[model samples]
Target: MNLYQVAKTVVYGALSPIYRFDVHGTEDFPKEGGVLVCSNHIHALDPPVVGILAPRPVHFMAKEELFNAPILKTLIPKLNAFPVKRGMSDREAMRKAIQLLKDGNVVGLFPEGTRSKDGVLKEGLAGAGFFALRGDAVVIPTAIVGPYKPFKRLKVIYGKPMDMTPFREQRASADVVTAAIMAEIQKLLDAHK
Candidate 1:
């Protein structure tokens, strides 16, 4: 198996037994094309949860500081994670994400930029929006709801791609797309909760 498949298997093996994951809307995820998987950040497990539930492998953007650790620096890239410098514009990371999407790969990220610490949703950031536009990706609005307790159900829903046609015609800014993406996620959260 490929490294991504191997790691996914290991993570699934570890998490599946501990948490009962109730996933829905897998059909909403497109089988092909550049897809931007945008979601709300709730817990540290959010990324992996989305990654595992996704029908395809996901390329994740992690904070640059994570790459400072020796083992993580060695291991993270193999798992399809790239580092982004926080609190500043990191053009290199953006370019990488755009390239991945343009190549028809699925790039997943939490638009809130950090963990919420509490289960409450945080304000969205514009990076995900920019990535979607620049990569010409179909932005898939996804949501994960959890305070993550053992044996409690962890819910993940992948909503349909946000209709970017209007936005594209209007030449919408990344900030505008960010707002729409966040609102859709909120709806998914409310429905599932």
Candidate 2:
């Protein structure tokens, strides 16, 4: 395994039982191709949760504020977390995400933009749909059922890739695509309820 894989495994193992991580549809994760792994954000732990549960290495875009803290500043970027300015489209961050996908790495994205305080999937921002369409990458809609108890059981279900070819060709509205993707994620989230 590579260094990142080792780091991911160690972190996940150590945090396991605490997160009680339950993963489904990992087999649906592409083994050797670029993929856009999009999920609803319900907690701060979403990035690490997806990273640990995903079959392939996953990269995430985080808020620039998260890197303001000294400890996180040092750690997050190394863990493949890049920064996006809040309330603005951080082109550089978007570029990095596209690069990762182009390089055949899985990029983790939260369509909700931020954690859902009510544990409900929020309206998706354009980032997830934009990246998928722009990158021409496969869209993997993931739903996380619970962040439950901090150290309790949580279920993360990944659905099959949604083809964006039509969306691309038709020059579909980003809001429409975002809503559709969130609905799909909500369906998965509802299954666990």
Candidate 3:
């Protein structure tokens, strides 16, 4: 296993008991090729949870501020995370994400951009769809219920891979693509309810 895989395994092993972790639809994960794992951002733990629980090693685009901290600067990269400037399209970060996807790696993204304090799925940004289109990656919609209380079940539901080929062929706008992805995510969340 690579360092990132080892780290993910260890982290998942350690956190599994502390929080009642349950995963569904792991079989839906792509065994090979470029994949974009998109999900709603609930808690700060969402990224780590997705990264660890996923069948493949997933790289994330974390907020740039997180990388500025000395400890995280060193540790986050080891966990396969790159920095992205929020509220703006950070082209450099986007390029990195696209390259990772092109290399046939799974890339994790929170379409809501930031964690929702109220636990509601916010409107998604177009960035996820952009990467999925540019890299021709399969978009996997994911839903994370909660890690609210200790020993309480934190559910993660993975939906089927969303084929972006049609959307790309249609030359769909970012807003249209984002809406489609959000709709899929909403379905997963509704199922969880």
Candidate 4:
């Protein structure tokens, strides 16, 4: 296995026992092809945790600020993460994500744009929807609960793929698609609660 895959396996192995990590609906994850894995951002741990649990490798759009760190600058990219400027359209980042999707890579995104400091679900931004529409990717809604503290049970639930064909056919606006994604995420969260 490659270094990244080895690292992911090690991390997942190490964290699983300590955090009592649980994953559901992994069978629903697409084994191949471009797919958008959308999740509710509750903690910084969300991306790596979800990425490691996924059946395939996942590339995440992390805030550009994180890349400023010397270690992260080198490490993040190795982990298949790219910087994205928050509070802006960030067309370059979008293009990069789309290209990855077009190349049949699973891209992980938090539709909320930022983490929920209070652990409450926030309204999603249009980026996830945009990527989904642009790449013609299937959206997989994932919900992560807990791992807030050491030894706490952490659950990751993967919902079924959300087809974008209808939205595309109707020429649905970004806001409409985003709302639909967010609603599905909320449902996954509530189901796990």
- Candidate 3 per-residue C-alpha lDDT over 1-193 given as tens digits, one digit per residue, 9 for 90 to 100: 7778788878988898888988999997889999999999988888889888899888998789999898988888888899989778689999999999989999999988888998888999878778878987899999998856888999999899999999999999877888899999999998997
Candidate order by decreasing TM-score: 1, 3, 4, 2
Candidate 2 lDDT, 1-193, residue by residue in tens: 7667778989888778677777889887788768999898887778888898898878887779989997989877778888888787678988998888878888998888778898977889877778888886888999988756867778899898888889889998877788778888988888876
**TM-scores, each model vs. reference:** 0.95, 0.90, 0.94, 0.93
Model 2 compared with the native: what TM-score?
Answer: 0.90
Shift of residue 34 alpha carbon in model 3, Å: 0.4
Worst 10 residues of 1 by lDDT: 160-169
Best by TM-score: 1
**Tens digit per residue, CA lDDT, model 4, 1-193:** 8868988989988877778888899998888889999999888878889999899999988889989998888888888989889777788999999999989999999888778988788999887788888886899998988846788889999999999999999999888999999999999988998
Please list the Cα RMSD from the true structure of every candidate, rounded to 1 decimal place: 1.2, 2.0, 1.4, 1.5
Model 1 steric clash pairs: none
Compared with the true structure, what per-residue lDDT tens digits does model 1 show for residues 1-193? 9888999999999999998999999887889988999988878888888998899999998899999998999899999999999889999999999999999999998899887887777888888778877887898888888868899999999998876668888899989989888898999999999
lDDT of each: 0.88, 0.83, 0.89, 0.89
Question: What is the TM-score (0 to 1) of candidate 3?
Answer: 0.94
Q: What's the lDDT for candidate 1? A: 0.88
Residue pairs in clash, model 3: none
